[model samples]
Target: MTVREIATEAYRESVPVLVLSAVGGLFAGVVLGGWTPETEQVAGLLVLVPALLATRGNVYGSLGGRLGSALHQGLVDPTLSLADERVNAAVAASLANGVLVSMLSAVLAVGLLTALGRPSAPLATLVAIALLAGVVSGLILTVVVVSVVFVGYRRGLNPDTLAGPVVTTTGDVVGVATLLVATRIVLALGGG
Candidate 1:
């Protein structure tokens, strides 16, 4: 098939997955609520939510897309009973992308917040939280996205059709959960 044909086919297959992702987002939004920080705490760790989640979703979603391509090209096995080199490559790629995306997102978010005159806890605290949260969340997101995509592929579903939406939606949910947990940990340390 031509490039256009492949693109069209991918788009067509994505319709159902898009619907499912939307539903997942709505469900997550309701369950998580605003998660907005109070006026007093607005400048603290609150702003990390969007950044962390966006990074998680983008990186994992991108990886899923690649995995889908690998699947199509017969470069992937369902059991991943591949050689050590291949396994290492997959893990390295996922981690590298995840870390890079997370750091970029965090930096961008911090810059945006600063530009908007938002109060921040401290430069060190902000950086620490952003980097730590990014790394930790990225690792978890890697597992979640890979597992979901692998399972979907095994079931004869197109990863391109399902991975992005599923990964992004789940990333939102997981991201929020991760941020909240991280915030609680920080608060606990601060004797809150």
Candidate 2:
């Protein structure tokens, strides 16, 4: 593509994602700000935040990559009216990864906190919050990434270019919100 073409396509392809990303950023800031006091009060929860958020991004971002590859290969429909097999498989794998990774991340976070002689939440509480938050956020992000990829493909744009940034941004915002809710629920349940 020529420079002018590239510029035009970039503007066309990226604007929606960028605008949504800005919204996501604002939501993330709110979630962070609101969650900060509790997170500081609980030692292990703060550590879980980064790992939980990263897991959401990694899982959904990879799903986007696979879908983009399939789009390029003429394997995916621009729509999912028939419930595409590849998309189903991708979602299943992503969910499985979300559950497993969230559990592991919680364990790792707790371990690290203990190693550092930091006060820690109960192991079960940390694990529950991480697993619940990660799975919920991952599911939401999967849908968002899939929608972005489908729209990008339908618009004759490369979904690969659009998916990464969008998924990461969505994951960050939704992940934090999900964590906050899960933490509250866990604490209410006497887990914290």
Candidate 3:
């Protein structure tokens, strides 16, 4: 496709994902509301929220962008399989980035809170929750992002436009939900 055609297609494809992202964000807001009590229980969990969300968006959202680029470059086959070396490498990198970045973000959150003399959860607990939640959210996002990219491609849509918005929205919802679960688990183990 020519540049104008590609841009138009991307714009068209972005519409649905943007709509879904808004809807999904609304749900994530509700989940965050419910998280109030849990955050109170583990003070630092509050601090970790933004970092976790950023990690998700940065890692998985970028994964979508990379996949789209690969498809456009024909480095990754148009098929949805990991049979392509490029696809395998990208997936592995995304997964690693998701987990590691989240853990580091947790540490950064703790450090930031400490520097400000704010009360926060211990580094260990924060790290644990971030890692666990990151894994859960990451796994869910990987499948969803990959599927959406392929579906968009098969439907003659640009994956670039759809993947980022969809994955980020999903990351918001799944990331919060998984973080909540991880927090509860931590509380159960150590009384928050």
List ranges where model 1 is wrong by over 4 Å: 1-19, 31-39, 42-46, 82-84
Cα lDDT for residue 116, model 3?
Answer: 96
What is the C-alpha lDDT profile of model 1 across 108-154, one tens digit per residue? 66687788887666555555555666667778877776777678888
> Candidate order by TM-score, highest to lowest?
3, 2, 1
Clashing pairs in 1: none
lDDT of candidate model 3 versus the reference: 0.85
lDDT tens string, model 2, 1-192? 799999888888788878888888788977788776678656788888889888888888899999899889988788764478888998889889988999999999889988999899989999989888977887788788888889878888888879978988888888888889989888888887
Instruction: Report RMSD (Å) for each prediction in the order shown.
Output: 3.8, 1.8, 1.9
Which lDDT value does model 3 have at 52?
86
Model 2, residue 54: C-alpha shift (Å): 1.4
Residue 23 in candidate 2, Cα distance off native in Å: 4.2
Kindly report which residue pairs in candidate 3 clash with one another: none
RMSD of 3: 1.9
TM-score of each: 0.76, 0.91, 0.91
For all candidates in order, the CA lDDT equals 0.69, 0.85, 0.85
Question: Over 4 Å off in model 2, which ranges?
Answer: 1-4
82: Cα error in model 3, Å: 2.9
